[model samples]
Target: MAWIILLIVGFVGGTVGSIAGLGGGIVIVPSLLFLETSLGVISNMGPQIIVGTSYLVLIATGLSSTIAYMKQKKVDFNSGFIFFIGSGPGAIVGALINRFFETDQFAGVFGLLMIGISLLMFFTKSIKPIGIIKTGKLHTYTDENGMSWEYKYSTILAIIICFFIGILSGLFGIGGGSLLVPIMLLLFGFPTAVAIPTSMFIVFLSGITGSVTHVSLGNVHWLYALALIPGAWFGARFGAYLNRKLNEKVVVTIFRLILIIIGFRMVINAIIG
Candidate 1:
């Protein structure tokens, strides 16, 4: 029964995460905790195991979405790789940091993070992009309407920002795309079309590093990951398609509310525990 529930959680997490470019780990981590602590549907999953398992599932989610976006020529591999330069090493350090926290403490920190991300999503569009710098690596995107948009960024600044993003990813088992997409838009001046897919590419790379670190530390719950992987992969593909077809504002608004609710719940639970 728990495994069956995990399948659905994975599907929903993957679909929502991919469509939003946030990665499924946000939903996966909280859902796992809820199942373990609230419902007792699963047993013996500590914060470390939950985080490790979530990152493992994110590998599938990120890969599927990235592939789908790539087919549409939406992914910016050059930028993504550059961002990974700092993120990869940062992820290693974050995973190490994650090793110290037990359940209640981790829950409090993670809950606050989820709420912050929720607010970020809510205000995504209203937040204006940073003014064009015109002094760094310039990139352009041509929309279906034949409008051309160009953006630029300092490689050094991008790498520095991504390092902190990677720390959050590895520490929290989130895709960090929630953070990455905005930075790409606000700081790097990436067009939305390019930013979303590029964010997923970075997620995939970060997932690899985060997963490897967790596995080395024996933080993962193999059975939980097994239950989640297949659904997450296919759901991400479906989500990528939906992302191309639908207006994202509605989806993002609703998802932000959900994250807020879940975040507050986790925070309360941690306090009570």
Candidate 2:
């Protein structure tokens, strides 16, 4: 019965995360805690273990979504790789240092981060991307309306920003899309279609690096990962399908609302705990 619940959690997490490019840890981590602490469906769990388990689940979610998006030609492989170069190391560092912080202390900060992201997305309009170096690449996407959206970014700047995001990903199991997607959208002026799929590609790569650290630290619960994998894999594919059907503006609106709700929830949970 607990396994069944967890499978459902995975499905929901993957679906939402894939749609939003938020990496589903937002759902997976919280649900696992609810199961363990509230319902007693699982036992002997700690926050670290839950985080580790979440990253393990990300492997499946990221890989599945990356494949699906790639097939649709939605993924930006060059940009993804560039971002991963920085994020990879950052994730490892975050995992190694995660043990030092009082996990609850971060709840308020995380909450604020989410809230701020929502506000930024809500208030901002499309703008030209900054290029710290002339070597940055230009990416373009054509929407169903036959409108082609073009964006560019600096590789040096992106790498720097992504490294920090990777640390956050490692620390929070967030897959960094919550932060990366917005930057891609606003700072880099990437289209909704391009930003989300490319974000998933980065999530997949960083998940590998982050999971390695978690595994070495014995933070993962393999059984839980096993339960989450099938649901997450299939759900991600489904989410990718859904994404293709939605309007770009609609997707951004959904992203904003979700952030606000999640931010409020995180703040409340922190206060209660």
TM-score of 1: 0.97
lDDT of 2 by residue, 111-184 (tens): 77678867876755444455334446677888767899878888889999999999988987778887888788
Q: In model 1, where do residues sit more than 4 Å from their true spots?
A: 132-134
Maximum-TM-score candidate: 1
Which pairs clash in the backbone of model 1? none
What lDDT does the true structure give each of the candidates? 0.88, 0.81
TM-score versus the correct structure, for each prediction: 0.97, 0.89
Give per-residue CA lDDT, model 1, range 1-273, as digits (tens): 999999998998888878878888888999998899889999888998999999999899999999999999989899899999988888888899998998999998999999998887666677877675557867888987898998888888889989999999889898788888877877667888888888888889999999999999998999989999988998899989999888888888888899899899889989999
CA displacement after TM-score superposition, residue 82 of candidate 1 (Å): 0.3
Predicted model with the maximum lDDT: 1
